[model samples]
Target: MTLKESSGVDNELNKGDRLDVPFPSICFFDLYTLKVFHVLKLAEGQYITTFALNKDNTNLLVSTADKQLIIYTDPALSLKVVNHMLKLGWEGDGLSPLIN
Candidate 1:
């Protein structure tokens, strides 16, 4: 989406920034349902120049109009996978960690 409209040279993407000024946002959506799942929180007012998703779909790389490069990772994907017999949802059973 285009950035919030401003007047003059500061009107375009990533020209000038202010703490109180609100800018455009980028959102990630589920391909199957076309529903937004996550949003990429970029630097304020900077338009995305390019972006790439890793082959594993765990990492995202972004380039902005201001020449800023950023990478984002999903923590849930980074978390270790384990099978616990004493499990009762996400609550720690206190013994699971010791075994894992």
Candidate 2:
């Protein structure tokens, strides 16, 4: 999986002699599926500096050059869902029948 930046401004900003531009966008790609799953616009024109997954692989942490860190959690991997899957004898190797 990778996060790529797309260029082009969706809007413009003018601040006296300095113009703040909105050009970069963050996109989430699924490596196994070779598909783009999601996209987020960089309103402040900051580039992504770091991207990491939590130890449990349930949380994704994204850091930008503007010093902002965002955390994204998987709802399908929540505690309740895991417990339910466990009750259904899921070994965690394949797709859960309850998923869809």
Candidate 3:
């Protein structure tokens, strides 16, 4: 239920080692089963545009592909329906896009 300690992906990592870091793994603890769960995916991918974690860290909101917002309970699973209302040919910025 708590993160006691963590290590970077690099084997040569040390205290204050200045370098680009990778998330080793995302772990979740189950109170009922009294077990810790984690997943490791070895691959390269595009950068995360935006991410919002719940105040309790029990949920997550991820935004990608210009107009897709996904909600997740576990990092790999979609917890809820993401209703996306998008304009076919819209342009501009922010929540309300200016169409020309």
Candidate 4:
């Protein structure tokens, strides 16, 4: 669950931004605290293929092959975009065009 701790790892999360890493794993860090917050398990039987960041750098977009797209937004803000996506028929494929 935990990734190797190194300067490289820090580089991945330096700006509190989103990144699409191919590895089937994820690492969490606290921006304000600069601490290792979590080492989470990847979704069961689902390999993460790509990810993206909202323009404001407050939310994260994650994609998986299980026909799912997940959005992680700042808890303080309302999750309107995600709700809208759900409201519409926009499935996870909508994000494919934006991944590259």
Candidate 5:
């Protein structure tokens, strides 16, 4: 299980974070302790061919032997509130006409 074929983004990230592409699953792990934090199982017969992380280590792009490219993002780093609805907006009255 070596990543020599990887694009080497993992070499630039924090030493604590890494991914393990075992048969049928991708595992999230702490490289220091070799502890697996999470395991994402792929479709029953799928396996990974290679993977790379973004420059800042917030995104993972995986190439599968099954002819698929899967992208995994770090939610806290990759997500934003693109749009939000204020709970107190529009409906100003506590009572509605339907209540009558």
Candidate 6:
């Protein structure tokens, strides 16, 4: 989808007091490949407060309103972290190994 369409879908998904709805995962689009290369779900019930990528694009920083900051050195590692969190039944407040 185009950026505009993606934004619209995101807004719709976030609308209302839908506490039961799990928050969408974070996804990174690869411009060169013209596709999504990574996705991770880090928090629930909190919007992302900050997202930053290092100058070399080798590191990523994501912060949520729940006072959690996750630093990802690479997409593969990030996917692994998110999957581990899910398997452990993370509820958005627990300490995570990925947190920095």
**Pick by lDDT: which candidate is best?**
6
Residue pairs clashing, model 4: none
- Tens digit of lDDT per residue, candidate 2, span 1-100? 2222244423233233342333576667799975657766675647778888888788878888889887878776787777787788887776455564
Encode model 4's per-residue lDDT on 1-100: one tens digit a residue: 3453643477556566655443566678799976766654566756677888888888788888787887776665655666566667566955422232
Q: How close to the true structure is residue 63 of candidate 4, measured as C-alpha lDDT?
A: 87
Supply candidate 3's per-residue lDDT for 16.
Answer: 50
Query: Which ten-residue region of model 3 has the weakest summed lDDT?
Result: 77-86
**Where in model 6 is the C-alpha error above 4 Å?**
1-22, 32-34, 75-100
Error of 3 at 54 (Å): 0.8
Error of 1 at 92 (Å): 29
Q: Which ten residues in a row have the lowest lDDT in candidate 1?
A: 80-89
**What TM-score does candidate 3 get on C-alpha atoms?**
0.29
Write one digit per residue (lDDT tens) for candidate 3, span 3-82. Answer: 32343354444455443334432344577974655443222342346778888776767665455565667533332212
TM-score of each: 0.49, 0.45, 0.29, 0.42, 0.51, 0.44
Clashes of 2: 0
lDDT against the true structure, each candidate: 0.64, 0.68, 0.48, 0.66, 0.67, 0.70
* Candidate number of the best TM-score: 5
How well is each residue in 20-90 modelled by candidate 1, as lDDT tens digits?
32254568668997666766566665788898988877778888888888888866656543333334445
Residue 76 C-alpha lDDT in model 5: 57
**Model 6 TM-score relative to the real fold:** 0.44
* Candidate 5 C-alpha lDDT tens digits along 1-100: 3564365556556565654455688877799987888887788656788999878777789898889999988575542311111222333345222332
What are the runs in model 4 whose C-alpha is more than 4 Å off?
1-25, 30-35, 39-41, 79-100
Candidate 3: segments with Cα more than 4 A from true spot: 1-47, 74-100
What is the lDDT, from 0 to 100, of the residue 43 in candidate 6? 57
lDDT of 6 by residue, 1-100 (tens): 8885876766566576343323556776689864666667665655788989987776778887888787878668668777788679785867545544
Ranking by TM-score: 5, 1, 2, 6, 4, 3
